[model samples]
Target: MLGSQTQTPPKEASSSITDKTKIKARYFMIWRWHFYAGLYVIPFILMLSITGLVMLFDDEIEMITYQDELVVMPEAMTLPVSIQLDKVQTMYPHGTVTQFIPSKAIDRANKFDVRLADGRSVLVTINQYTGDILGEIDRSDSWYQLANDIHGTLLLGQWGDYLIEIAASLSILLIGTGLYLWWPRDHASIAGFLKLRFSNTRLFMRDLHANFAALFSIVLLLFLLSGLAWTSVWGGKLVQAWNTFPVYYTWGDKPESHLTHADLNHGSEKELPWNLEQSVLPESNQHIHGAYTSSETDKGYVATQNNINIDSIVKQARGLGFTQYKLFLPQSEKGVYTLAANSMGGDITDPRLDKTTHIDQYTGDVLVDVTWDDYTVLAKLMAAGISLHQGDVSVFNKALNAVFCLVFVLISLSGMLMWWIRRPSGKTRIGIPPHFESEGLWKAGIAGLFVVAVCFPLASVALVLFGLADWLMFKPRR
Candidate 1:
């Protein structure tokens, strides 16, 4: 019986062997792709994590840095908005007041964003209660803005943008394959994937990397997606096109302005909410029955009328159920008055509270009123995701994001170390995972490659380069 059993394997044994081989093949394929993606993602992810962590506390940092300018005692008799504008306009006669940001809390100074005639922007602080100009800061010189530029572009301008897009694209593959590999095998306890194995150096780091990455996998993915949704190619060109807010009504035949909200972000740290990512702006029409609209006169704009007109607009904003919103002043001769608020850090600090309104500068007609509910399904998701990613939504979210960033830094560094330590000694070539020959690899990969290429063109370019190298030097020899 033993000799017969040895000579002819049982059907169950044969099936088990086939399943094991299949799992091994799948593991190697995933591992290979994960390695390829990591090579490009590690440096950029580290930079993003670091800069993001810095930007998470931007509000608090700015408050601390500009405390003398931002603070005020509680008082009911606040200065009129026009008086504050007059004070700033007179000081920088060469400047135009673009936006007035009120403190969400009453007991604080108001901010005026002025565009100087010399082509610079400055943040002017005026005490609402005292009506005194407190301090002025050149907007571009802010530390957070510099860090934000680096986070977005590595300080390399457009080239930096492309590099980040490629890295961000490949990161999708990195995290996806990582989760696949991170799944516990054979119904094993959480020890391998969740619990860190510190018994051995390589195993300890590997386990630590796996466990932490697995823990933060969902959060990491959300951050990556939100960040990508802001990128030039994937988010701007592909996603934002279909996800942009659609205009529903028009008061006149006035053609929309060529500029979108993005035009406003040209020289500023503030960004438009994701919902307005691609909405065409409406232009001011001369037909609305009004003499220069609200708070206006025939001889150029001035600071007077006790803000009775804008207060009505504020009342209207309140009537629309807005508790907190920013009133961005007209930017040009035909610029509109924009009352904006979103969950982003600038305003109410809750993504669910998003609201934006654009009123004609010449006629004071409501051009557009968009609330959270008006956002596209994709834009709504991006709004919430972006708030979480920015860590401005909650203390817990901010702390969790910080932890994830730290863990990612550890995972990236330790991953490199693991490869270095475990590499085949004395080998001239990279000690890549053993890519055992599988007839289905190229065929199976084609579908994924095509999908990635369609979604992220820059990453596709990287993959094409890698594919060429693989076919030339790394393809398994039969």
Candidate 2:
């Protein structure tokens, strides 16, 4: 009995040691992942945070930078829409006016997006009452537009988009692993929950990094998921495809044009609601009234006052209760006029008020009209979420997003600083987290990898490659 008792105590002690060893191994495994994720995501986080801030406050920036063009004196009476178009056409005789953005405020200058003869798009600002040419800015060259492009595509087109998408996807894993590391193991450790400590240099940086992460984890995740909906592979091809607005229900057996609402977008700058991007546009030209024809005038070839002219379109928009809106001109004879008022176009602050109406270019007949209520549940969420992400909801939203961006930069910098401070000096190798080899250590992470693969295929591919490289180059210390 004495021998059995001694043996039982040794067995319990051995089991306890084994349990602790596995726990430590798991910690190192997660920490290693967190480290690499931070390493790759650091630069991207900086770029995105900066560019995101620029985009979030694009209106304010433009107000300061282009006040002459964006702002004007308020007048009691405004010139007619056709006259404005005629004035713009007189200035750019060879340019194709594709879109007209009308400001609801009387003091703001009206905008006309014209494609010059050289195939460059420029936004021409025209005074509403006086019809004076304020100025023309290259749509792609504007600071806000450039920042928006970089924010979405990194100026590398599809390749840049893919890179950003990969970084964003892996960031999910970063947040997950970070949360796990921040989680307290016991009551004593719980004191540090979201509390920043500055007593020691390492602890200060650590606390800053971890605390900000914990503080903004939920909001950051919301941003990531909503932003992912714009990605080519995961969001566009998958989630977007699945949740795209049902055109059949709205159009009711009408023939669809080859072009979609995506054609309305100017590169990465989306002008349509998320669910409507893929919606098939309705064809026109079934009722071409002779009165609704284009004519050449001394000013320029402009749409005259007719049944389907620019004036009628403006009236139609107003009749439909569109206050601030954009009119996308029909491209071809069969193209339909698109009147859009949505948060995506920065026309309104509330996503619930989003509305898009397609009008027959020749007949002026309403083809299809979509409102916020027409959207699917997921689409509605995406619209509001996107508005929130862009800081278009309210002044408070802008302030919160700005704070988040600033803290994100701080967190990213602190993470890199901590890594740099801890890394071995004058060493070519990164001071990777210690690795422990235990039976099924790799297996423990398989479920997570599978989930990631299912949700984000590109991120999973990256994880696989990273895991293989780590296994080959860095053997377990144990």
Candidate 3:
């Protein structure tokens, strides 16, 4: 009975060995497809990686090149918001003002945006006292912008963007298959996982490729995934899911009767307007009259009801601890002068109130005042994300971004090197692994399913065509 059991055990072991062999063969076939795809798409991936690295430190480069224009005044009085607007208008009479970004930090001093008569937008930094245009920045002429153009679309626009998306998708597949290939079947040696002797050229190359990929795998994945999210359909869906909160801006109806600057200062307590009704005050009346206003005692003061001059308004804003303030002049009969103040106390990264004051052009009465602290939670998050992304959060953030750029360049170079070394040669060598092959129709079918699952429409179509070719070349044997 013991001899018979031993004989049965041998037969069972033989069957199990055969099953394991078939499974490995199947995996090998899938790996061949991945290898070929990586070889074909590597050049495109290399270009994207290189260009993306340059774009990471775009702000630093801009600062270095435009030092004269970017420098700020040592001690300029906070000019009236309207006076600043008038100065900008006087300097560029043909250009129309689009947006006035109140100074938030040293980098933002006297800077504002204007759209020229020729449809080109220009970012200008001006002298607050003389209103002289100190420096004009054209994004079209910027090297960083040029690099962004290449990184985003290879300078081919939407078509380039799509190509990048395809490359990213292929990279995911390549990494997955590469990881599987790296896994040893039963080798217990540490040398197999990490260390490799440089005596054999092929082994050195293979090890170099595998080790680099393993080391920077997570960062490379994040870089590719974030980029794809910007350019691909599925990636867009992923980003949308990540940012699910809605961004909404509410504006009140235009006031029925315009209030003059005089109407605001002497308004009767009996006729004090509703909060919503008073919300449309022109830009000039928004600053806190005193150094500070408490929530309980200053409800009336919060209403736009002042007729201060633009120069006085700027002084008041500065006095109230606002380092950066921008004033806008009303364009038409019903337009309100606007004053925007940023008062986070010189810490760009710190969250603070963004105050907007609307003052009646005719009357000096304040119409509407809104604060940054009053924004919805989602809106605040979005603002902070944008600031961080733009390298505008703080000096420390800008330095960190520069380091991130250097890291990105290293990652791209390492990835390209890995791809080049692992490229297959037609000749089969002893140390170099030969291409994997499919044994039966079922194995081929599984490979097709995997290709379709990863590549979506392109792989699905390619698989169908491959199947058709197979049928024509070798029909099933009965």
lDDT to native, each model: 0.75, 0.84, 0.52
Greater lDDT among 1 and 2 belongs to 2
Worst 10 residues of 3 by lDDT: 266-275
Which portions of model 3 miss their true places by more than 4 Å? Answer: 1-10, 104-108, 186-192, 235-478
- What is candidate 3's CA lDDT for residue 143? 72
What TM-score does structure 1 among the candidates reach?
Answer: 0.87
Candidate 1 Cα outliers beyond 4 Å, as residue runs: 1-22, 186-191, 247-254, 266-270, 287-320, 473-478
TM-scores of the models, in the order given: 0.87, 0.93, 0.61
In model 1, the Cα lDDT at residue 392 comes to 75
Q: After superposition, how far is residue 67 of candidate 3 from its true place, in Å?
A: 1.4
Q: Which candidate leads in TM-score?
A: 2
Is candidate 1 or 3 superior in TM-score?
1
TM-score (C-alpha) between model 3 and the true structure = 0.61
Encode model 2's per-residue lDDT on 114-208: one tens digit a residue.
98777788889999889999998787787888898888889999999898898999888899999999889966347567787777777778878
